[model samples]
Target: MADAEGDRITLSALQDTQAIQGQTVILPTALGVAPVETTGDPRIEAGWFDNGLKRARKELGQADRSVGDERLPVLIVTRYLVDGTLHEDRAIYDLGFALDGQLLGGTRVRIRGLSLITRVPAASGQAKLDARWKQLHPKLAS
Candidate 1:
């Protein structure tokens, strides 16, 4: 949707699916994951996940800037839950269950990207959904 000035526009997903709703939409940082250390302890795998989350948060913050001279809204959905098979490179932790089967309650979505980890609520039909998203995920805003 375009603002009153018509120079800046806001865009967001219209679908309610987990893939579209929960995905931590971020711009690519590196071409791919850095070369894995062959000799490192298997326990370091957790560290890799932590580093990835940090990078994803950083990139999402950059994408939240307003348009033109005015501030526009940007939404960041994290830990988005999905029901289908994600490709090898795309899959994060397997919730190991169907989206419908799980009792998500207030949890709207969950995203686990290569370097991103977050969750967001199902979008309310608001013009300022982006701003609301930022409000909900303060860490990403930082």
Candidate 2:
């Protein structure tokens, strides 16, 4: 949960401030469950990064009857433990929210542009392919 003062709460902050270090952040999928075991502090790129994927954006119609009209994206960039080695993974972003007991589009939490952890610029074709492969194929790429 975020603060009352409109201050966006980051996943890294949540993981750090609440002594949630060493916890494995898992993101479930239809294929299987993807767990991101943290190796160190998360590296945040910005307030949010929207890839224009509607699956991650919430519906802004008249059905919103829960929280106030506050919807934003937060991406979690961190070093994760992979095969006993530290690797910088993808930027996990969340923009989904539930309404009327139904799970809508993008999850309130989600992971996008993830790879096998790298020090490259993260803009290489191999990196994007790797990220997509992992997102689609799951454990095979990991």
Candidate 3:
């Protein structure tokens, strides 16, 4: 998390510190499941991303409860593992939290921009797609 003076604060420090009303904290999404294949079914891929958001929301909610009114402004950054590679996805700056539930307006979070540091495009065409499918989803393909 970044403080007003631009100093980074560790998670443990943030929990112990007090009255950080204006500070901004980065709440990263955890990959609870295995890495998803880039060339896999679109629905499954989308679900994986959705699950990451849910996980982040749950964490933020828990933290908010623990901190008890010292909830700093949160920036939820959702990450996904695609084809055994990690990719940082959308970063939601504005969010609201509630106990025993998800972040308010979570699903409506806008994907403002994509920052792709480097990308290795998956091989193209049917034969390559088939080969990649089998390789990536061995049990399912089998």
Per-model TM values vs. the true structure: 0.19, 0.26, 0.25
Please write out the lDDT profile of model 3 over residues 1-142, one tens digit for every residue.
2232222222211223222222222322242444333222111112333355445445434221222111112232233454545544322222222223236633322122212222223232223323432332233221
Per-residue CA lDDT of model 2 for 1-142, tens digit only, reads: 3433222323443233233234333332321223444444333221232222222222212222334332222223454444455555434343332222226543232322222333234455344433543453233221
With candidate 2 superimposed using the best TM-score fit, by how many Å does residue 3's alpha carbon deviate from the native? 2.4
Assess each prediction's global lDDT (C-alpha) against the native: 0.29, 0.33, 0.29
Candidate 2 — worst ten consecutive residues by lDDT sum? 44-53
Stretches of candidate 1 off by over 4 Å are 1-32, 35-44, 62-92, 95-142
How well does candidate 1 score on lDDT at residue 120?
Answer: 33
lDDT of 2: 0.33
92: Cα error in model 2, Å? 4.6
Error of 1 at 117 (Å): 16
